[model samples]
Target: MTKPKISIVIPTYNRADLIAESLESILGQTFDSWECIIIDDNSNDNTIEIVTPFLKDKRFKFTTKPLGYAKGANASRNYGLELSQGKYIYWLDSDDIIHPLTFELCINEFSWNIIDFCRFQRTVFFDNFDVKCFDNYNIDENVFFIDKSHIEKIINNELPINTCSVIWKKKSLGFEKFSNELLYAEEWEYYSRLVSNGLKGININKVLIYARKHSCSQTHEFNCNNYIRVEAKKEAALLIVKNLAAKKMLTYSLKRYFICLSIGFKEYNLFEQIISTIQISSVEKIKWQIFYTILPLRLSLYKIKKAIKM
Candidate 1:
């Protein structure tokens, strides 16, 4: 009968082996005024069996992906956002673990200042949480006050804002939702779009989420040579470019970065898409053409050098 202070939305598929641990992490949270919503993307595994026990607690709600709806994590997350009944929303993966104090720290930050979202660092681990591999810590600064300029950092891959790290104010999101067309880089595009629209946020400089770096994870499977993943990256880049273009904030360096990604991923269509979105000088066009033509030579030379060393 009452809305919670925060809602944790997790989109999952066939994570039966790890879903319970993720749920238990939520159950162990120090903050109590929160609800957890799990949207299953039509998984064939016994994921439901693992989740059923947690439903008795009343704070955890589980639902299957609506039939005929776009089938992906993006769609599931959108549905979770629609069903959420909290002031703040946290997007988390089904296989990741949030620190016990995540909600308490984020809620405290929200209370002190009016921000669209609160962000924290995340640690990556493999096999188990004890064997940590990486962290998204900014060595030069402990706290980061983010604004529109940070969107460029995201586009440049200078910042790592994963789906699990940021807790967003629901109303501040307005009509924005995840792009269902994207299977990869959806979080990057969504967060970049929000930042481009002038969302204010703060980075708390604490690793509050533990991201699992197993081979089954999407990030691990995302390869530049993978056709579907490459297409998703192109779509995401185009969408972000259009958003920045509308705001008259599209920078030359940002455009170059997108072009490089497109070329590096072997998705030539993105080059044409970028040209159609905005006007490019003749010199820039020629430069891109030359770079595209020389790619084979560059690869050959690199391989030759490696073979010589071997």
Candidate 2:
């Protein structure tokens, strides 16, 4: 059998009802030289039964997460990376839909040998399939080069680059792996590493994927627990700051770290550790110290504002 040019790695858990649509979208792709690797993370649902019909096509491969492996999307993705034999890697979630021309359009950009990755926009859909909104991160540029400012924007959460909307050359990824320990914000950390390491890529300025926002989504679940989500964001922020420092962006890193510390103020011990460990101007430090002292009042005011809005 001929080797596929692109490997679409999809990590799923108990997505039996939604995965069929994702698989069918892949089957409908305009590009033919691609393989779909569905890594099941020990899903007890009939995910296998739903995907079985698609296996008739040799390009659609499914594997269960090995025993003792971490149980999460990141671990499943890492496993899929190990088993992938394609030249390029695209990460797709089991509940998302890819446009029929996504692979064709992105792969065309690789004609330039210097390109290491490509990213496109995505349209987010609500649970009822209503169009919630579109991510217009790079919608203006035909092919925008990623620079320090762009990296900073991404690290600061000012940009929207989801896993499904990006594709990377397998060789450019080297030994990098997503953080399996993080239940949230793993993508932010992983992408920060990629950008800091000078992984050159372009944004296609087109929507090529449909990201579904549902009650059962991981982000939604994480958001329901503010403390857990904030802690995870802090961890991701720490990693990004460390990477930025390595790249000689100390001031920016400190500012980002400060923001993270502010957000996770409820986690006093962790917040204090981060404040002490990260370097900042003495005046800035004093300001944060004052802010920390008034953190409770700030939180109360924030709650009041939110309650008023509601």
Which candidate should be chosen as best, given lDDT against the real structure? 1
> What TM-score do all the candidates reach, one by one?
0.88, 0.86
Question: What is the clash tally of candidate 1?
Answer: 0
Candidate 2: lDDT of 248?
74
Candidate 1 stretches greater than 4 Å from native: 131-141, 287-310
Kindly list the per-residue Cα lDDT of model 1 for residues 199-257, writing each as its tens digit: 89988887788888887766766742566776787788888888888888888788767
TM accuracy, model 2 = 0.86
Q: Ten consecutive residues with minimal summed lDDT in candidate 1?
A: 131-140
Write down the lDDT of every candidate, Cα atoms only. Answer: 0.84, 0.80
Residue pairs that clash (backbone atoms under 3 angstroms), model 2: none
Each candidate's clash count: 0, 0
